[model samples]
Structure formats: C-alpha cells, structure tokens
Target: MLAALPVAVLLFDDEGLAYANPEARRVVELDATAASSPPHVEAPAVVDAVNRARRTGQAIDCELERDGRQWQVSASPTACGQVGVVITDLTEVRRTDTIRRDFVLNASHELKTPVASIQALADSLRLATERDPARAASMLESLEREAARMSQLVRDLLDLVRLEERTGEEEPAEADLAELVRTQTTRVAQAAAEQGMDLRVDVPDVARVAGSPGDVRIVVANLVDNAVAYNRHGGTVTARVRRAGDEVVLEVSDTGIGISPEDQQRVFERFYRVDPHRSRRAGGTGLGLALVRHAVRRLSGELQLDSTLGQGTTLTVRLPPAPTSVAAPAQPPPP
Candidate 1:
C-alpha cells in the first residue's frame, strides 16, 4: 500500500525511525535501516512538527526547505504514540507562484510608465496650448511618443502571452536562417548608418531550420535591432549564419557598452534593464530579449550570451536544421 502511494511516508516511534517507505527514504536521503533521523532532512520545522504531533497526539502541518527544494510536510499522531509523516514535493508549485507574482508586478510597472507619461504630457499640452503654442507643439510630440510606447508595450505583452501558451503542436516548416539574417540586417542597416555605425553581414548560401518563418524573422529582427540600438557611434555590428552539425547557428555581436555580470543574468527577464534611465532614453521597451528567449524556446533552440563589462555583448542561437527532404526551395544569393 505504501509502495503505491505518491507522497513520501515515514513512521517515527520513541526509538527514532520505525519505518520508511521507498519514497520517504529517497526524499529524506537516509538509510531505511538506520535507527536515527535523516541527516539531509534536518529542517527544524519538520522536527518540531513531529515532536508536537507526538506530544499532543494531534496532527500538525508545516513547510520545509532542503537543498533549495520546498516540501509540504504533515505529521499525524498514531494511537500508539508513533508519528505518521507525509511529505509532498512543492518545488514546481512554488516556482509557478513566483513566476505569476513577478509577471503581475512587472507588467504593472511597465504599463504604468507610459501611461503616466501620456497623462502628464496631456496636461502640459492642455495648459501650453492656451498660452504657448510652441511649447504645446513639443508637448504634443511627447504625447505621441508616449502613446506609441504604450501601444508597443501592449503588443509585446500579447506576444509574451502567446509564446507562454504555445502548445508545440504547430507543424514545422523550413525557414532559412541565412535569409532571415540578411533580411533583418538590411532592414536595420539604414538605422545603423544613421547612428554612424557600421553593420556587417556574413551568412552562408543557405542555413535552414524547422520553425515558423515569422517566428524566425522576429528573433532575427529583435537581435539585429538591439545590436544597432545599443551600439556606440562608429561602432560595428556583425550578423552571421552558419551550420554546426545538425544545427544551424545565428549570431549577432555588437560593439556597444557591454552588460555587467549582475545584469547579464537578468537581461532576458521582462522589463529588466541594465540601466533603466539609459534604456528609456534609448527607446528600449525591455521586452526584446525576453521575447527572443521565448521564441527560441518555442523553436526548440538554445541561446547563448557572451559579454564583458566594457567590451560588448554577443547573442548566439542554435536550432535543429530542417530536414533535407523538407528544405525550402533554394533562392539566389543576395547581391
């Protein structure tokens, strides 16, 4: 009967451990034949719960943490003074709760920024239009900018939700990484030129993967756009596509102010910025990397980040190559 149960179960008598099922022994990391308490299950709360259940002949419940994992623990007293203990793993449950909490808080903060700006801009425009037409025009421009920002934020939030809800049931199709790299690089070349930066594109004749074309483009566009946006004047950005075994790789490297170690770990988090003030001034919504990460996951790909404090940052992505039989029709190389 204990062997069929899902949760870990153990019985403790006055001597120490009277009985421990396989689940209990595995979770507690203790010898089932040992007559002492488990060393790894040393949470004081568990001990207290067991002692209280024995002393009062009443049931007790508590939470215990061990080795970075959460466990729900319950102790019930038997008629003979033995304690029946049950433990349920709660690590994944706690993780879901944390993700939900952070999403709500971060979403609220991001939405509030542009909404507040739009409101303040509207008030300034109203007052300035009556007395200062030139000031009113500037306020109107500010209002438009804030409105656009809010719109973009909403769009990005929707994209994140869609990615999170992905079912992985969509049929895959051939998508050329080289084409995506070339198209995205060209689209941003003008922007890079305007910023006095050079954009370099190096790609193979064809590098294809099995995924949605639109999704691939989104990934490439965001990476290339960020490379251009974060780069310094006269700096250079490089986009590359190549094949590694059964995988195709897409890489974007930028000569911008690199991310600090602390920020690098959180750069993929929604609305997380290395420098909030600088990011805002650079017109960054802070959702680009987050979206890129989610899109890559949906493609069953891997993303790697390499950066230094003052040098630059590089993002590399690898995905399974499209099957030869299903590869897209070959197109002429870009001139």
Candidate 2:
C-alpha cells in the first residue's frame, strides 16, 4: 500500500519533532522548524506509549489529541535514528468501544443484583426453617420476587445481545413501513391502556422501506413502548408513518416529561437512564434506544430524536426505500 496516501505523519527523535509528512504536519499541529520543537502530549496514555516505544523497540499505539479532537497515534523506531509516528482519526471507534464496554459492564452489574439477592434469600430460608414458618415464607416471597426480577433482567440481556448481533448483519428487505407501525402501535396500545393513556396511529397508506420486517417491528415496538411506559399518568402516545422523497419516516411521539439537552446524547447508550429511580420503578432495561440505533444502522437508515424537558420526546426513524424489481420467474425448459 505505498500507493495508498495517508492523512498525516510525523517523525520525532529525542522527544522533538525531526520531520513530518505533509498530511501529518497539517494534522498533528506542527509548525515550521518543528523538528527542533517539543512533541506536545495530548493524552497521558499516549505519552506513556511513546515513552515505552522509546525505551523498547515496540510500537506506541493510542489515542492522542489534535485540534481538540481524538486521534489514534502509532509510534515506532525508524531505521535512521528517528521515531516514525502515524496519526489516524479514531473518534468514532473510540466512542463506539466506550459505549459497548459500558453496556457489557452495566448489564452484568444490573443482572447480578437480583441474582445475588435471590441467592442470599434462599440461603437464609434454608437455614431458618426451624425459626418460624411465617418468616421463612416471607423470605420465600422475597426470593420469588427477586427471581422474577432476575428473569426480566436476563430476558432483556438476551434481547440486547440478539439485537446487537442481528442489527449488524446488513440484512435488507422490502416491506410496508406504515403497516409495521400500525401493527406495533396496536400491540402496545394495551400496555398504554394500563396507564390510562391514549395511543393513536397515523400511518400513510403506502409508506415502504428497504429493511427486514422483523427488525423494523423491533424499532417500532421499542420506541412506542418507551413512549407509553415513560408517559404521564394520562398522556397521549402517537405513532406516525409517512414518506419524504426516497426515505420512509416513522415517528413515535409521547406527551411525557421530556429529556434534557445534556442527557440527550447519553440516552441512546445501553443501560443509561436520565432518571434511574423512575426507570427502575417502570421496569425498563434502558436498552431501547441503543437497540433502535443499531437497528437503524444495520438497515442503512437514520434515527433522530427531538425533545424538550417537561414537554415531550419524539423519535424519528428514516429508512431508505427498497428497489422495485421483482425476481424473474423460473422459465420452463423448451423440449
């Protein structure tokens, strides 16, 4: 790949810049006569890596700073008494990795609580058999409740994992978007009814998308379910589907306490909730938006949200249109 041009490069020795590739000079923020200048440390991790690569012949690889943005830095010893450094923008990868790691750890920690509680209660019940049947029954009831909580947690974990895997498969299909929204709206209507909330649907007759029906249903259900579950005591949940040019848009809007601007970015994170106490009381897994994001990415679509604190939130999903060619029928052989 010598033919493949890079974005930036830098050469440093003795903790000072020696030479730099044109792209590297512009990107790494180096000026004229930088060879005599110091190599600025953007991150401690990267500085450590550089020190390690200097002490040893190993390469230093880490995220560094350039123009206040994160970039991947790779430093290695060169043949001519110089250190070769390569910088690549890794903001997206770093962000995705951070979210993924948080998801795994949070899911484990959340699921472990109920399981550990149940285990403790069971042990107590076993040892307290001769103490009092009433107390033993109470422990048994707590155990059952924790057991159910554990079951729900486990189900949500599995659902998150399944969605995580399937949503990256890039499977696309032709289907009616309006019908999918209507179906999901009908399904969640009963759940909304439990809270005495009104659920309505406004679907265009022929909105279509180029995505798997199962995945589309998932996106619809999660959005609608969140709207209903997080809504006020007597709120309204609306599911609307339409098309704008070549994009099919599905929106789920609710009259609930909306999200704040600061927390809006974190809402799509797995196991993240603006109000943890209320989320737990409402029995949410906090993986809804995360799943929706993955589904949208796999479907080659875009998912956007608009919300105002104390007003409401709207989730808008736009899916690309499917191609309109049917497979040719099998032709009979001519005798």
lDDT of each: 0.84, 0.76
Q: What is the per-residue lDDT of model 1 for residues 53-79, given as tens digits with 9 covering 90 to 100?
A: 988889999987888998999999988
Candidate 2, 1-335: lDDT as tens digits: 32145655666678566556666656655564644556563455545765778789888788767566788889888777677777788877788899778767988888887888988998899888877767998898888888886786776667667766763445447777777777788887777898899887877656667877777777887898789877998899988876667777788999999999999988988788988888766667777788788878867899999999999999999888778622222234349
Model 1 residue 316 lDDT score: 98
TM-scores of the models, in the order given: 0.85, 0.69
Candidate 2 residue pairs in clash (backbone atoms < 3 Å): 8-24, 9-24, 17-35
Candidate 2 ranges with C-alpha deviation above 4 Å: 1-19, 31-66, 69-97, 120-172, 204-208, 322-335
Worst 10 residues of 1 by lDDT: 325-334
| Model 2: per-residue Cα lDDT at residue 296 | 84
